[model samples]
Target chain A: MRRYLRIWRIFFTHSLIQDLEYRLNWWLNAFNTLLFLGSSALVLWVVFTQADAIGGWTFDQALTLLGVYLLIEGVTVVFLVPNLNRVPQYVRKGELDYLLLKPIAARFIVSTRYASVWWVPQLGLALAVILVGMARQGTLTAGHLGLLALMLVAAIGTLYAVWFALTTTAFWFVKVDNVSELFTAFFAAGRFPVSAYPGWVRALLTFVVPVAFLTTVPAEAAAGTLTWGWALAAVGVAALLLALSQALWRYALANYTSASS
Target chain B: MRWRPRASLGDVIRVDGLRKVYRVHEKEAGLRGSIRAFVDRRYRDVVAVDDVTFGVAPGEVVGFLGPNGAGKTTTLKVLSGLLHPSGGTVRVAGFEPRRREGAFLRGITLVMGQKQQLSWDLAAVDSFLVNQAVYEIPDAVYRERLGELTEMLSLDGLLRKQVRKLSLGERMKCELAAALLHRPDVLFLDEPTIGLDVTMQQQVRRFVADYNARHGATVVLTSHYMADVTALARRILVIDHGRLVFDGDLSALVEARAPEKRLRLSLSERVDRADLAALGRVHAAEGLEIELGVPRADVARVAAAALARLPVVDVAIEDVPVEDIVADLFAQGRAARAADAVRAAHEAGAAAGGRG
Candidate 1:
């Protein structure tokens, strides 16, 4: 575990240096990330102002959920999304060949290779919003905070599995870049609680996309509304998904043609 | 581990009837196949490797030679475990390469000229350090290897500079250093010196040779450049059209295929074109200087007799180059391939016509 962390740090530092090369692009992208955050906050503010509560919580509760949603989105953008985007390029250019030859796990390398420094500020801002919302609500329990921390870690792990499985389709389908984009579009619905929608819509969000676990379920734990059974279920589901995705990645790697012409 | 059977160098690397076949999606140029592909895809089997078998004793430097699409890289990929073989067996350092266990991957390295492993935007030193951690090499060993490679490749100031800012040769040197940080026991170099100046090319060749000699490491290299092979490889493996055509000593292949001798002349005056043509084919000519090809049997007599009669300024006899020999082999291979293609087509057409 320590060795893996060391490798991850090295990889992160390497990606940081690479990203810093285009200083102008970084600044422009940083501003763009800010715009995305501003728009998200504005939309949430307007939605809460029009209603006393969204689904079953007060304005502060909805704000906290929105804050967690932004934080999750920002985390994915900073690390997972960019690395997933590289998967198909690796296939097309045969760069995956080198990655596979390494002693470490190929999935680990591909999942964390590229880091987007522009998303850092947005993540910080999202965390700040969560903190501010918590302070305003007061009456925060230690157990609730602990559960939120566990759910946060579990959310990141589950997201890794989801991204890995989607990107590994590059092994079979040469042009799946648009498919990944469509997946992100579908996942955008997770910003709201599943209970806010009708029964069939809630079922679709739960079974088809599983976006509820990414946002509402984690936010529920932070808001002291999560059941212990659901918390165990979330951890169990994340472990299963992580295992399944890694198995799929290995299988796809075995079937890889490596851009032969 | 110490109580296990101690295997010798002879069994270091062995391959038996290895094969790889790729299912490639076939699409026509027009919009019709594209539309059809969206609904129903068509695929054909491309046999990238067909029963290629060979072995390298430990510490032997072997050159894998082939044309662009002749499966040299595919074979290396299989041996390195980047791609699973469709059939047959491969063992390197007594481990299955496809398993890609830490022990197996630690024993070898593959360098491809077209793809870079270095962090393109960072200083070369940072990339090397990253490699050091990943390969888990001790700091002292990393420093020593880096120092030696930097000195041998003349990468003094290039290490501190960003990889993007370096020239092609400079970047290639940094890449070599990164690849060599752990000092792998088996090296697979694919076009390592593809694009470099003459001096840089020689430097790389020397470095490879010295590294192999010092560590007694097994090395297999694939390249289109015959100069790289001739200077470093004693044994050559030639593959064509996804099959092994020849695998033997370099000198033997040259002697058998390139038997003709070259006669170079710096004449005192311009000789008649007809006269030059009569002796042998004029390989090259410029002003009073000329290079001619002559059969081995007639080379000595032709040179001696020509010098006696004409005002010969300078005359020399040398063997034909290895590049020409490989070219001759490739031409012969292509003709044979064309013939096979025609026969296959004819048989297919006949069968279809008969069925109709």
Candidate 2:
């Protein structure tokens, strides 16, 4: 465990040094975060102008849900997206063998290899947005913080599991970027709470796209109305997905043909 | 069919009946076939690295020679644990390579000429640092090895430069440094000097030799350049059509595959093709220069006869080139392989009929 951590730390430093070579990314990412926030805020204002409440949740509740969505997006963009998406290129180019030959686990090497640190500012702002929403609802209980912590873990783990499971399919279909893009489109639904959508859309988001576990659970945790049952269920489903992805990764390695030299 | 007995005690690497089969998706040549194939995908087994068995004792350097797609790279991959074998077992440094245990991986390294492990966007130094951590090299040891490699590979300025920005030779030098940072006991280098300038190739050769001498590391290398094999390897293993066709000393391989010597003669006058052929098999004849291939046993008689009959100004006898010998080995295998396939088909038919 310590050895893997050391490798991740080294990778983090390597990424920082590499990012320094492209100094313009800081400004570009800042601009990108603002663009995302502006569009989401515009949609929220447009939706609330028509309805006073969205599926029984007031405007502040929906705002917090959007904030949670952005938070997940920020974390994914920072660490997971850039790295997971490169799995296909590595498989196609046969560069994964180098990673496989490493002393550490290949999954660990690929997962934590790249980081876009420029998104840290937006991550902080997303946290502030969640806190502000909680304050407005006057739900500042210690129990709420504990529930939020557990839900956040489940949310992040589930996101990684889905993305990684999709990415690992590259071993069989070397070009699945189109399917990954579809997953991204589904992830956009996380910007709105599942309850705001109709019943069928709620089921699709909860089961098919997993946006509910990603956004709604954490938003409910911040809402102080979250139940222990919901938190445990999210954690259970996330654990199952993580184990499946890990098993798939192992099976993929065993059958890897390693693109000919 | 095995020549050398398996070295069970002292060998750093061992393989017994190693085989790897690839189920390649067959693609069709036309639109109709492509659609049919897409509708119902079919695959065929490609037996790469078929029943190959070999061993390398501690600190031994063996040159693996084979034609393109003759399974040299596949065997190397299996040895390095990148590809698991369909049949047989491989052990390197007393551990199974397929398991790829941390200790086993730390004990071996594979360097492919066309591929690199360096982070392209970062300086080479950053990738080296990554390797250091991944390999769990102590800080003091990492610094010591870095200094040694930087000096050996002439990587003083190259370390800080982005891998993408460096020249091919420069990148290769840094790559070698990265691969050797862990100082693995078993090194599997496939075409390590490919696409390098002559000077760079020579430097790489010398660096490999020096590293081997200092650390006594086992090296298995494959290259198109016979000079590399001749200069470094004491023994050579030749693979053709996914089989080990020849395994012995380099001199023995040349002597066994080529039973003739090259005789180059410069005559006082232009000679007839018939007269040159009379001396021996005419390899080349232009104006006053005539090259002949005479039986190794008859070289003395052929030289004596040529001197007495022709106005010989100069004559030199030499061994056939290793490249020609290896090429001839592969060429011979192609013909023999067709006959073997036919015989195997006949045997299969006969067995089926008998069973019926």
Per-model TM-score versus the true fold: 0.90, 0.94
True contacts kept of each: 0.64, 0.77
Ten-residue segment with the worst summed lDDT in candidate 1 chain A?
A: A252-261
| DockQ scores of all models, one per candidate | 0.55, 0.63
**lDDT tens per residue, model 2, A27-56:** 788788878887887888899999998888
Give the per-residue lDDT of model 1 (tens digit) for B1-356.
Answer: 01112223476778888888888788877898799887888989999889887888899898989899899989988888877788988899889887889998988999988889887778999878767877888888888888888887789989999889998878887888888888899999999999888988888899899889989989999999998998999988888888877787888887778668999999999878878888888999899988999988999888987888767999999999888888888889999989999999999999999999
Q: Name the best candidate (by TM-score).
A: 2
The positional error of residue B166 in candidate 1, measured at the CA in angstroms, is: 1.1
> What would the per-residue lDDT of candidate 1 be over residues A137-219, giving only the tens digit for each residue?
77367877788888887877887788778888887786678866776897788878889989999999877777878888878
* Residue A222 alpha-carbon offset, candidate 2, angstroms: 0.8
Best by DockQ: 2
In DockQ, how does model 1 score against the reference complex? Answer: 0.55
Q: Which clashing pairs does model 2 show?
A: none
lDDT of 2 by residue, B220-328 (tens): 9999888888889988899987898887788887777788999999999876778888888998888788889999999999999999999999999999999999899
* Among all candidates shown, the one with the greatest lDDT: 2
